[model samples]
Target: MTEVTVLGAGIAGLAAALALRDRGVSVEIVEQAERLTEVGAGLQIAPNGTRVLRALGIDPPGPESRAVHLIDGPTGRSLIRMPLGPGFHLVHRADLIEALAARLGDIPLHLGRPVAGVSDGGRRLDFSNGQTRAVRRLIGADGARGASRHFVAPDHAARWTGQVAWRALVPVAGWPAEAQVHVGPGRHLVLYPLRDGRLLNVVAVEERAEWVAEGWSQEDDPQALRDAFANYAGPVREVLSRVERVHLWGLMDHGAVPAWRRGACTLIGDAAHPTLPFLAQGANLALEDAWTLAAAGDPAAWEAARRGRVTRALATAQANARNYHLTGMRRALGHGALRAVGAVAPRAMLRRYDWLYGHDVTV
Candidate 1:
C-alpha cells in the first residue's frame, strides 16, 4: 500500500487527502492547529472549483449568487451586472470548511502537530513533538508559509500590492439575492447574503501606501471600517454599522515559483501558487491544485498540467486589482463601459469569463 502524508489540514490539504484516498492511496494529514476550524468571512467556489468538490462527494450547501453587481459607491448605480450561471456559488468560509471536513472520513488526521522540517527529498519530516516520520510520498498543502514549502523552494520573492482588505459578516433580513461590489476612487466594498439568506457577508478594501501585516487573524475596529467608507451609500453604511467585528489583512502579489517538486514530494494550493485575493480564487485555485496533483500521478506531470492554468489565473487576479481601484477619467470610463454592457447585452459580457467558470479540473 502507498502511504502519503499531507501537511496542513486546510481546504487544500483536506481535498488532497480525499483525492489521494479515492485513488487507493493511504493519506495522513498533519495540521498544526488544535482544532479543525476556519477563519475569514465568505468565499466563492466558482463552478471551476466546485467541480473538484462535487467529484470528491463534497457539495458546499451555500447559496449561489445569480449576478455580480459592480456599482458606484455613492449612488449605488449599477455599473455592470454580470449574470451568473450555476457555477458562481457564494459560501461562508466555515460552512464550506465543515462540508470538506465531513467528507474526509477515516483519513488519519494529526492535530497540533506542526512540522519542523523535511529532509531526504521530502520523504521524511520532523514534527514539533520531536518525532520523525518516513513516508512514501508527501504533499505540501500546508500553505504559502508552511514548513513543507521551504523544503521545496527555500527562497521566494514577494511584493506588497499596496492594498489592504477587511472582512465582516453582518446580519440581514433581506438584501438583494446577488453579489454586489461598490467601487470608488481607491476602494471597493463587496456584500452578499449567505447561509440561506440569514447573514450578510461583507468585504471592503482600500489601497494603502504601505503594507499591513501578512496574516488574516489581525482584527480591526469596526469604526475604522465605517470611517474608511463613510461617504458610501446606505446599503454599505448599514452593513458596516451592523458589523461588530472585522478582520484585516494585507494584499500581496507573489508570482509563480518555478519549482514546487522534489523527488517523492510536491506542493499544492497556496504552497504552490500564492497570489493576491483580488480574483477571489485563493480557495478555488487550491482545490484545483489538489485534484490535479493527486490525479496526474507524477510531480512533473502535475506541474505541467497545472502551470498554464494557474499562471493565467494569477494574471487575471492582478488585472482585477487595478481595474477595481481605477480613479479619475479611467474610473469613469470603465464604469461607463460596464454600465453600457449591462444595459445593452449582459450575457455577452459574462461570456468573457466562461473560460474561467467553465473550467473542470476534477478529472
Candidate 2:
C-alpha cells in the first residue's frame, strides 16, 4: 500500500516522490504521458529552487546564470545589467525533468494512466482505462487542467490575461550566460542561453485581443512571432529572423486555488497555484512545496505557513508583467528610474530580490 500517491510525472510530482521517499514514506507516481518527451523551452532555477535541489543531493542541471540584462526593445539600448549570485541557473525544461526523474530510483511510476475522475473525497482515483484504486493519501501535482486540481478546487476557473507568449529556440554559439529582457510597449522579449550556451531560448510576449488556446503545445507560424516584434532592432531582431519553429500559449490568470487540501488529498505546484512566467517562481515554488509537504507533520499548518509567501510571489510576478509592458510616459518614467538606480547602485537592484532568491527551505 502506498502511503502517498503523487499525480503527474512533471517536476512537481517527481520531486515530491523523491522528497517523500527520502523521508521513508512509501510513494508512487502516476503520469498520463506514455513517455517523458523532450518538448519544452528553457526555464530559470533561482537560488531558492537551487537550494532545494542541493538538499535533495542533486547537482544544478545547467550553466550558472551570471546576470540579467534589461534592455529597451525598440532601440536595443541597455537599461541595466544586474549580477546574480551563486545558485542561479538557466536550464532546459527537459534537462531539469530528466534530472529529477533520474533520482527517483525504484519509486513506482505509472505512466500512460490518464485520470478519468477522482472520487471518494480524493481517496479514490479512477483512470481512463476503467481502473480504480484507493489511495491512503493523494498529492495533486497534475497541473491546472488535470483531474487532481478539479478534485481539490472544483469551482476554480482561470480567465485569459489578454496576452499570448511565443517560445522558441535558436542555435547560437558562445552566447553570454545571462538573461536578457527586451522591454517594449505592450510587449517584451526574454532571451537566455541554455545547454552550455549552445542554444538561445526566446520567449516573446504581446498583448492581444484574440484568444489563442492555452498550453505549450500550440504551434504558430514563426512569421507571426516575427511580425509581433518587428519593431525590435539589433540582436533581438536578428534572433527572431533565425527562428524556424515556435510554440505559442495564451497566458491565463488562475490565481491561487480556494483550497489546497480536501480530506486525504492536497495540491502542490500548478494544481495549487498557477503563477505567471514573469517571476519564474512556478517551478521554484513547486520544489519548495515538495520538500515542505514531506517535512510537515500537519497539512493545514503547512498550508497556513506557505500561503503568505506564495501570495507575495504571485503578486510580484503580476506586477512584473505590468512593469515590463509599460508604455508612453510610464515607460519613460519607469525606464528612467531603473536607469538611475542602475547607475548609482547596480548591486542594489539585485539586492531587492533577496527576499526571493535568498530563501532556503531546507535550512
Candidate 3:
C-alpha cells in the first residue's frame, strides 16, 4: 500500500487527499490550525475550477449566477459580459472550506500540529509539539508561509504587487443577478450574487505602497477604500457606504519557481504559487493543482506534468493584474474604448473571456 502525507487541510490539501484516496492511495493530512475553517470573503469558481470539483466527485450545491460583463466604474458602462456556462459557481470561502472538509470523513487529520520542519530523508515532518514522523511521499498544500516551501525551495519569497484588496458580503435582495466588475483609475470593484440570491459578494482592489499585510482578515478603513474610488460613479458609493465590516489584505505574487516538487516532497496551491485576484483564479488554480498532483500515477512525473500548466497560469494571473490596474491616460483611454464598444455590442465584449471561462480542466 502506498502511504502519502499532505500538509495543510485547505481546499487544495483536502482535494489532494480526496483525489489520492480515490486512486487507492492511503492518505494522512496534517494541518497546523486547531480546526478547519475559511477566512476572508466570497470566492468565484469559474468553469475550469468547477470541472476539477466534479472530477473529485464533489459538487458544490448553491445558487448559480452568470457574469455578463465587466464595466467601467466611473462611467457605468460595460467592458465585457459573456455567458459563464454551466460550471461557473460562487460560494463563501467558509462554505467551500466546510464542503471540502466534510468530504474527508474519518481520514486522519492532525490539527494544531504545525510543521516545524521537513527533511528529505524518507520525507520526515517535524511538528510544533516536538513530534516527528517519516512518510514515503509528502505534499505541501500548506499555503504561502508554510515550512514546506523553505524545505523545497529556499530562494523563493512572496513579492508584493503594490496593491491591497478589501472584500465583504452583503444581502442580495436588492442586488443584480449578473456579476459586475467596476473598473476605475488605480482601483476596481466587483460584485456578484451568491447562495441563491441571499448574499451579494463585494471585492474592491486598490493600488498602494507600504502596506504589505497578506491574508484576508486584516482590518482596513472602509473610508480608505471608498476614498480610492471616490471619483467612481454608479452603485459603488452605495455599496461602500453599506459596508460595516471589511477584510483587507495586500496582493502578493510569487514569480514562477523552479519546481513545485523536491525529492519525495511536492508543493500544491499557495505553497507552490501565490497569485493576484485579478483573474479570480487563485482558488481555481489551487484546485486544479490538487487534481493534477493526485491524478499523476508516479510521483517522479509530478514536476514534468504540472510545471508547464502552473507556469502558464501564473503568467496569465500576472498579466490580469497589470490589465486591471491600468493608470493615468491608459486607464482613461481604456475605459473610453470599452464604453464605446460596450454600447454598440455588449455580447461581443462578453465573448472576449471565452478562453478563461470556457476552459475545461478534465481535458
Candidate 4:
C-alpha cells in the first residue's frame, strides 16, 4: 500500500488530495493555517477549471457571469465583450473553499502544521512542530517558498514585477452579471459581482517603480487604494467609494521552474509556477494540475502534458499586463482591434481562445 502526502490545503492542495483519494490512493493533506479561513473575495472559474471540480464531484456554488467586458476607462464604453464560457462563473473565495472542504470525506488533514524542511532526497518532511512524516509520494502545493521546493526546484526565486495590486469587495445594489476590466494609462480595474451580487469584487493593478513586499495577505488603507486610482472612470470611482476594506500585494512572477520533481516528490500550482493575476488562471491551472498529476503518475509525463499549456497561459497573462497599461498609440490600436473583434466575429474571437476557455483538462 502506497501513501501520498500533500503540503498545503489551499485550492490546489485540496483538489490534489481529493483527486488522489478518488483513485484509491491513500492521501493526507497538511496546512499551516489552523483552518480554512480564506479571505472574502471572488475568483473566476472559467469552464476549463470548473470542469475539473465537477469531475471530482465537487461543484463550486456561485453566480454565473454572463460575459467579460473590456470597458474604456474614459468613455465608459465597452471595447469588447466575450461571453463567459459554459459554466464559467464568479465565485466568492470563501464559498469555493467551503464547497471543497465539505467534500473531503475521510481523508486525513493536518492543520496548523507548517513544514519545516524536506531532507533525505525527498523522503522526509520535517514539520515545525518537531514531527516528521515520510510518504511513498508527495505533492508540493505548499507555495513557492515552501519546504518541498528544495527537493523539486532549488534555484528558482520569485522576481517582483514592479506592480502592486489592491483587492476589495464593495457592497453594490445592481451590477451587471459580468466581469469588467476598466483599462487606463498605467493601471486597470477588474470588477465582478459575487455572493449573489451582494458584493462586488474589485482587483485594481498598477505598475510601480519600486518593489513591494511579496505576500498576498498584506493590508493597505482604503484611502491609499482610492488615491492610487483617483483618476479612474466614473463607475470605478463609485465602486471604490463603497470599499471600506482592502488587501494589497506586489505582483511577483515566479517564472516556471525547470525542475519540479525529485524521487517520488513533485511540485504543483504556485509551487511549480506562480503567474501574475492578469490571466486569472492561477486557480484554473492549479485545478488542472491536480487531475493531470494524479492521472499521469510520472513527473516527466505530467510536465509534458502541462508545462506547454501553462507556459502559454503565463505568456497570455503577461501580455495582458502590458496591454492593460498602454497609453497612446498602442492603446488606441489595441482598443480598435478589440472593438473590431467584438463587432465582426465575436464567437470566432472567443474561439480564438478556445485553447483557453474551451480547454477541458479533466478528460
Identify the candidate with maximal TM-score: 2
- Compared with the true structure, what per-residue lDDT tens digits does model 2 show for residues 144-185? 888988988889889899999999999999999999999999
After superposing all C-alphas onto the true structure, candidate 2 shows an RMSD in angstroms of 0.8
- Give per-model TM-scores: 0.96, 0.99, 0.91, 0.96
lDDT of each model, Cα atoms only?
A: 0.85, 0.92, 0.78, 0.85
* 57-119: candidate 1 lDDT, tens digit per residue: 977668778998888997777788888888678888877777888888899888988888888
Tell how far residue 344 is off in model 1, in angstroms: 1.1
Model 2 regions lying over 4 Å from their true place: none
- Write model 3 residue lDDT over 1-363, tens digit each, in one string: 248999998888988998888888899998988876556567788777888888877776544656556777887766766555576777777788888887887678888889998986438998778989888899998988788888888888777788888888777575555678787667888888777777888888888877668875678777887788778884778777777777888887776556777878888898888777777777888888888777776756866776776677677777766777688888878767776776676567546667666766566
18-110 in candidate 4: lDDT tens per residue?
999999989998888888886657889888888999999977688778988898886788898887656788898788878888889999888
How many clashes does each candidate structure show, in the order listed?
Answer: 0, 0, 4, 0
Q: List the residue pairs that clash in candidate 2.
A: none
Q: Which segments of model 4 are wrong by more than 4 Å?
A: none
Q: How far is candidate 4 from the true structure (C-alpha RMSD, Å)?
A: 1.5
